[model samples]
Target: MDISQESGLVWTEVDLSGVFDLDVDESLELESVGDGRVLAVSASPDVVNNVLVTDNGVDWAALPIPNGFSPWSVDITGERWLILGRDPTKEAPGTQILFSDDRGSNWTELAVELGPFDGTAWIGNAIVAGRLIVAAVQSDTWQPQLDEALDDDMAYEPSEKHVHLFLSDGGPAELVAEFQGWYTGGHGASDGFHLIISGPAAEDYLLHSPDGRQWSSTIVDVHVTDSARNELWTADPTDGRFKLERFEGVFGSDQVLTLPDGIGWMPDLAVGPAGVAAVGGPASPNDELGGDFTLPDISIEKNGYELRYNQPEGGITLWDLNEDSAVYVFDAETLQSEGEFQGVSEVEDASGSNVVFHDPETGAELVAFSGEELAAAVTEEVSAAYSEYDPDEFIIGWSTDGTDWEWQTPQEAFGLPESTPDDNSFTQVQVAVGHDFVIAMVQTYEFLGSDFGEDAPIGVGDSQSDSTSAYLTTTTSPSPPRWFVARVE
Candidate 1:
């Protein structure tokens, strides 16, 4: 929840109970909001039959059925939905667009050509302006890979691919215009709204569309052999290594966010209020090995931060919030493989915030993704762990690293404290880590029970008296002897 940033220190705290339901996914699918709250759309091809949303981070609501495929893209205007789809297993004719007026609670189908040709692949939003919705969709015809598919030449059926820009009427999902190769991945907010596509047998290209209809495409001149591509993504341009070029008049185009070599892999794109945040996977040997198990890097945008998660073949998921010092690296085998990350909490009291990421150097603006931060202490370590919560008593705790954790309360460190005879209760708890400090903030309540009697009651309506209080506690994570960071002074 706490990530360090530039300017020495920058903090953005969000209350995440307002827009989410407990059945959401562990990962976030980013959505940008122009006239309303940002949404994080979640769809699990393995579990849930429906898609849901976490608005800004708090409220959780199910998206109305868009009946196209397992994976889909969402674009919201005020309360309208622009949903897209393409099924990997089914023929392309099944890919259709759906719309909704009442959030995702209900929906209406839009006319889209579902084809017998297996062409449509990745779809991206290029621009949203003045009631015009511009997007890029890729199409390729590949014959099904047989069970004996092994050799590189035998693995794929070589076919021509085309990337097209589709224009819509900005009402219910309707296609108004189309531009065919500029194979754009998820578009970035650089320059205006720049839609980037990895070119065939040449350098990747960036297509700029302001009104979401007319666009100018430019080849980036970064070349790669036609056979080298296992996947393509839009990376965080500031990292400096990935050849993400700068194009004028595109979103974030005024400034460049570079991708350092050996740092990022397949960049999953996310956009919120901040700007375009592309999170990439780790640069690993397995990534270069060219297999079906290649774990792609994941990135999402939100206000003030570009969040990324890396999933390697045999590792945990690691999240690095750009310029934010807290890099949460977790056991991916547990979080993702074991399906822990897929199990979103059912706690309804969570909230979300709209994140606006600004290019620190150029001050260029872009939106990031929305997320939910629950009131539970989410701990991650290199071992097996468990957490317990008492809804009736409003208490919670967890453990991972060891038996004697300095992170819990006496009630938590041990079990629940012995109930006081006078009836004392604790409530409103919070924990935080500061310079050499672990702080616990809380409030208390005390009540005096009335005298019990079968026939000697002074009055028919006897009650207990009540009092309230508040306080804080500080401790060490590994107990006092273990200093997290020793000071030289």
Candidate 2:
């Protein structure tokens, strides 16, 4: 795979093109268990699915599902792999949380249930803080499928009254703090300390734990970051602008850095270590494969870090959150100078040092300016090239904050093309940035070359047809879909 770099960040790709013999058709998540060992979960509904483990993307092995429960998500706590899923019961509502120590070869299931979990149910989002492994059981209002007819007075409002928290030690699950309201956010032990959970309410509780056994309660709501203990985002009621006030938690001491504001804080504004951010917000927004962001009248701070608009001036104000700070404008004018610059498409607030942006025309770019002495950037050729329905060929881009996008080269430079020919056609895929890696998941619909020679072809002979030709065609039988994972270093 091609490797790209600027400052402390390095963009690399791992080839998972045809790694799995099965067409991955479910939700996929990747967890790094240190020592370069990576665990991948193909969170499928059918119990016949296999659990995959890999040391490097080059080689992979399969582990049995152990039970009939369908996995919802996976998390890594210390040396254990926690796999959370649901039981077959739809009426009573059940949850299954499993712990894997031997790279998922074997599993120990937790017998704990929050009892009559109604409405929407999700489990197994675990974070390890000290001896405590807190898993969030979040439920949202049940809105039946739009295609499914509903009663006239059917409620679309979420019935989520509380977020159930649990503590486990690779054994029986114990119920912990069930915070008020649904759990809107959970940071998986950011900093290996402080498992931050939000969404209880506004004066809502910010349930945090430094040590698993003993916990402290606090009431400041911002984005969850492992880089910093806690960050405070405040805005003037009269003006929409906001500034970040960060402090070392426990002591309740913080530094108030007055910032020029234009962007409002999305309830989930998080800052990492080396807190320099574009700070304003991103100009473009995208979610899921067929997903579009809903809130416009709502605010950015309400939805976390996604920026909604860029100034007509073609740039947004910026700041560096490091010790020796210098500020610069997050410029997209040069990129806009390339074309219409159809807004910033995909954004990665990678690590905490640099932000990456991707536009179909602008490609991928990385920009980081800690000080004039420490400014770096890398951009790809700006062309509205392959608008073809391709997800694998996505451009890797960057930004200091999340706003202005700068294009960088692509994953092909690092040997990550799907096949030899070209990457297009397959569409369902999504990628997000993590502490030191890029996690991408692709949902497979049509079967790969997995079940070869399975289809029976029908040849139709046109009797009265002219002296001309016949056509031979092939078809892909839809199989139970699963998903696969790739971690870009």
Would you list the C-alpha lDDT of every candidate in the order shown? Answer: 0.37, 0.39
In terms of TM-score, which candidate is strongest? 2
Residue 368 lDDT in model 2? 28
Model 2: how far residue 117 lies from native, Å:
7.5
CA error at residue 59 for candidate 2, angstroms? 1.7
Give per-model CA RMSD. Answer: 25.3, 19.5
What would you estimate as the lDDT of candidate 2? 0.39
How high is the lDDT of residue 435 in model 2?
31
Q: Write the per-residue lDDT of candidate 1 for residues 394-478, one digit (tens) a residue.
A: 2122111111111222353223355443433333332222222222222232222332222321100000110101111111011
RMSD of 2: 19.5
* Top candidate, metric lDDT: 2
